[model samples]
Target: MTEPQCPLHEGAPRNHVLEDQCIRKGPRRGMIVASSKIYKDGSAEVKDRLKDGFAFEKRSCMHCVDPGCVSVCPVTAMRRDPKTGIVTHHPDACIGCRNCTFGCPYNVPQYDFNNTWGGIKKCQMCNQPGVERIDKGLITGCAEACPTGATLFGTRTALLEEARRRMKLQPGDVYKYPMGDVSKPDRWHEKAVPVYHKHIWGEKEAGGTNVMHIGAIPAELLGMPPLGERSAASISETVQHSIYSYMALPAVALAGLSIVIQRNRSQQDDNEGGQS
Candidate 1:
């Protein structure tokens, strides 16, 4: 049997098809763009290319431990599931402030410019109300369609263990990489292991993420920002809690507003009496 081609390589129609599927099935018309990095191959036709070959990675919301998008939203539009850890966006509650776009470290949340009435577009892991794939015991479209076992869907604990197992494997050793779901894979894709970069992206990045990445390429090269272990959300949440403790900030603002209104009324009354 012929091995399934990597969907991430340049000019791979599979990636485009997958993206189209995502856009169609998602709440809005936007795709989960997978970042593809082009490198030189050992081909005479494509000169000045590195012999090491090409590297590519899928990009989307990290579904952070303490998501900055969730923290910055004025309305409670962005919410993380306590049980599943899936971060979901509610269009009805969203004020279209575009705070999620600015606050996200991975630059995941996107505002739909084309549609005048469109809300924030993001990956909710097919767990949104209408789609609710997780609730139905179904995997994401990407994970289900990934023939090469490139995009496995499973619990964090199970995936982490698989990642650790892959990290320890020597390059060129044959291993059966699990396909579809990590916990109960439909089948295994047997292939020789490639040299893996020691670091696992999303393990401790911005206090960690539910969606993780493991690849031969360095994460920075795959367009990941250099982030510390501490999440920005945690810091922002702390400051916000301190300032708004006991509704102190809101109460002070209300008092000031009332004083301004009273002063305005007094001035209006004086002006009316002078005219009389």
Candidate 2:
């Protein structure tokens, strides 16, 4: 038992424990893609911020339906799990070309160019390297560890519903929201509800994403990528397929080669006559 004046609540959550390495481990090892904050007092607040005053943004992968990260990888190092649709990187297959980093519109991929043994990095959403938290019927580390029900995991369908429902709620109203997976919530976090920030990230940007987001910060601050309904994969596929579909590109190449050969032969014949 503590003193009467001492206020004791539940425990605070730890974000992706592995994520700290990305944020603060070393120049070569650490690369922070996500961040969080706490207001000293519930009364203190920032404009366009979550009303409850706690703010965090995990700038992880958009997990695009047609991800460039997967398409641009020459060695097939990056791939999307067909069953779960999680985009993941396979280190063994990687040739370290860094095409994925350049191809992605969201700038989600990370490269450890500082080390002698460099590697590509990104949040696999706990689905990589056989972690399979989703397949094992569990949730992501950030989602499970989030005490305020801030980070959550679930199908795109359920998450969108929860996000839309929150937007309709009255701000400042105390509400008990589900934590972890929305379908089978692990726990609850009750707080004075904050006003919706007006966007549910990863919904349709780049043709939608598996892991979604909703928070106070608008456009730039959220590190949200500007994308349209169509994914980069679709556009690339369309162009490549159209060019090759009729074998027209091959005809063009053959024509160019024939012209070069004819010019070479004509020059050689002229040179022989001059020598004679």
lDDT of each: 0.72, 0.67
Native-to-model Cα distance after best TM-score fit, residue 211 in candidate 2, in Å: 1.7
| Backbone clash total, candidate 1 | 1
Best TM-score goes to which candidate? Answer: 1
Per-residue CA lDDT of model 2 for 1-276, tens digit only, reads: 111101111111222112312222222223323333222224536543534343445555678888998988888899998878889888899888989988888766777666588877776776665566667787776677677676778887888999998878888898889997888886898877666777877787778788777765554444455678888888898988887877887898999999999999999999999999
TM-score of predicted structure 1 = 0.74
Model 2 score (lDDT): 0.67
Cα error, candidate 2, residue 70 (Å): 0.6
lDDT of 1 by residue, 65-143 (tens): 8899999999999999988898988989999999988899877777866667966777677777767888899887667
Off by over 4 Å in 1: 1-51, 241-276
Looking at model 2, residue 7 earns an lDDT score of: 11
lDDT score for residue 23 of model 2: 20
Q: Which candidate number maximizes lDDT?
A: 1
Which window of ten consecutive residues has the lowest lDDT sum in model 2? 3-12
